[model samples]
Target: MRTAYSVETVRTAERELMDRLPDGVLMQRAAAGLAAACADLLRRRGRVYGARVVLLVGSGDNGGDALYAGARLARRGAGVTAVLLAAGRAHEGGLAALSGAGGRVVEHPSDTSAPFDVLAAADLVVDGITGIGGRGGLRPDAVPLARAVHESDAVVVAVDLPSGVEADSGEVVGEALRADVTLTFGTYKPAHLIDPAREYAGAVGLVDIGLGAVLPPVAELEALQHADVARLLPVPTGESDKYRRGVVGVVAGSARYPGAAVLAVAGALHGGAGAVRYVGPAGDAVIARFPETLVHAGPPAKAGRVQAWVVGPGLGEEPGVRDALASDVPVLVDADGLRGLNAKVVRARKAPTLLTPHAGEAAALLEVPREEVESARLTAVRELAARYGATVLLKGSTTLVADPDTALPVRVNPTGTPWLATAGSGDVLSGLTGSLLAAGLGARDAGSVGAYLHGLAARSAARGAPVSAEDVGAALRVAWRDVSEEA
Candidate 1:
């Protein structure tokens, strides 16, 4: 799994590593990695020799790193120019090194002796306006320079982080640099993994500076790898029987929306469950499509034994919701079933509870605006988990799973495409995760693995074309095989 740390934690780790090393050892190491990455990029364009390299130098360590890297490029036959954002406060040693290595230094971008022309025609532009310590956004004076870089065709590379983004919260308050790649040091920052800021920070490259031993093992955010998901997947054993594998009970779909039942059952069928017992008004519709489903008309408790229950895909405030929630089996709540949900009842249940809410549903649950929930997805998901005492999966551009326990790391799904925004996709996800829960995986594992498979299936099915919710459900088996067969 790939992990990311908060800015404060990274700073602490960097300090500890620096204390044991020489004064400029860490900086030199960082500069070396940055220069190598720049050289590689320049080499890709043909040759590093005579390549125009422009560095936007600020007053921080980030700027110093850029300056030293510029010096390296100049020494290697690249035409390097440093545009200093801060004149007097710039790193003296770095400036001298760049000048000594035959690199030109320009003081800001003015109408007279401006480096705007150089920046426009440069092969590569390195953004060093701000680092992890920067808050809000870019300064007023630097906004024009940032705009100019964006308008240019240069492949922008951000040093450490894109300027004007909050490091810890992944929030882009105002103007920020959009990089083709970000070369981060020591460890991955929160901005590198989370959304908004992550979108601006295109492809991230970690430049290890020997701070691994000093950094904490716990990561604030984690993206599950193929190996991690494979381990959590349930596989049938020699001793496994129909009853032994697990049964998932789904209470979904109303007469008004029978398609919800079909989509949900479609996902449940592929979720490694031994059997699916569906209890709802759309039993006829479900039986018409999938005759294998055990259909019932009444409450979920009377729908025979089930290891896990999925309620509320198209259910319109039905009484069956109460019966399902009251059952001893693990329960997954989604769509209309999540409406007017009682937090106390969910918390009182002995079995695990998983809540799947999109931004609008989550907003209703939290009594906040939909925009608020969408903008602050991390905070909304975490808050929902704490309040309802259940595992919360907030689905959107990025899917995040948060456990009720705050100490546990939140899982962010890296797989997914914009095509997943189709209607009824969440229904499919709810059923799939419910089946996994019945198969004996914990709430967190079920949610994370289910999301992983769901997103992968969507991508595989679409393959760059527009796909419906049904296509996503049908591709589940393909996704399962792809993960299970991995060596």
Candidate 2:
């Protein structure tokens, strides 16, 4: 699992490690890594010997990092120039080192156009205008410089994080600098993994500064890798039978949208479930598509036996929402089932409950604008989970699964692609996750694993082209085997 810590936690860990080490040791370590990465990038573009390097120096240690890295690049025969945003407050030792190494220094001019000539000619730009401690956005004085950097053809590399994003919430409230690459230290931050802010961070590279021994065991966010997903997936033994493997009951579709039933049943069949029992008005449509499904036309209460229930996909004005919610087994609620949901009723349930909502549906449940949910997904998901006393899977650019216990790390699905944005994709996810729930994984694990496989399947099916919901369902076996092979 790839984990991300909060800003406060990282600060505390850094302070602890700094107290024991020499004064300049930690900064030097970071500078060395940054310089090496910049050198590699320069080499890839051409050669570092004659490359033009520009550093945007600020008033903190972030600027110091760039200055020290600039000195290293200069020693390697690169033409390095430091554009100081804070001429007086720039790191004293860093400035001295750069000057000793024959690097040029240019204080930022009041007129932003003055730096345009140098910025335009640079091969690489190092952004140190702000760090993780910065909130809102860049200072007004630095806006023009940022504009100049963006207009330039140089490859932009941000220090720690891209300037102007919230490290803890992954929210970019105002204008922020976009990076071609972001070099983070110690561990990843929530901003590096969640969306909105994540999009600003292009490619991320973790530069270890030996903070692992000091950081906490549990992080604020966790992204499951292939091996982690493989471990969580359910595999049947020789003794496993249809009933023994687990039965997933799907309460979906209606007369208005029969395809929803077929898609949900398709997802459940590929979700490692021994059998799928579907109950809805579109049983005939579902049977036509998947003859293996055990179809029932009655309410979910009389649908024989099932370990878990998936409700609410294309279920317009259906009656099974209440029936499925009232069941004692684990349940996954999505689409129309999310409408008119009561927090008190969900909190009262004994079995685990999983709620999957897109930004729009989540807004309806939280009584906020859809834009707010998309901007601050981490906060919204946590709030929803706490309010409903159930696990939540907020689907969008970045899929997040949060448990009701806020102390646990929110799981972020790293495998997501924009290609999975088809109409019935969420319906497929609801069924896949419900099957995992029936197979005995906790709500958090079920949601995370389900999202991982769903994303991988979508990517495999799309292969960079447009893919339908049915294509994603069909690619589940391929995704399962891909993860298992790596394991």
Report the number of the highest-TM-score candidate.
2
For model 1, where is the 10-residue window of minimal lDDT? 107-116
The sequence of per-residue lDDT tens digits that candidate 2 reaches over residues 400-461 is 99999988999999996798999898888988998998888889999999999999999999
- Per-model TM values vs. the true structure: 0.97, 0.99
Q: Record all residue pairs in model 2 with backbone atoms less than 3 Å apart, i.e. clashing.
A: none
* Candidates in order: C-alpha RMSD to true structure: 1.4, 1.0
**How does model 2 score by TM-score?**
0.99
lDDT per residue for candidate 1 within 1-487, as digits (tens), equals 8888888898898889889998988888989999999999999998899999999999999999999999999999999999988988899989999999999988884655467888889899998889899987999888988888998988889999999988877778888889999999988877787787889999999998998899888888889988889889999999998779899999999989889999999999999889999999999999999999999887887889999999999987566778888988899999998999999999999999999999999999999999888767788898999999999999988888999988898889988889889999998999999999989999999999999999999999899999888999999999988887882
After superposition of all CA atoms, the RMSD between model 1 and the true structure is 1.4
Q: Residue 323 in candidate 1 has what lDDT?
A: 88
Off by over 4 Å in 2: 111-113
How high is the CA lDDT of each candidate model? 0.90, 0.92
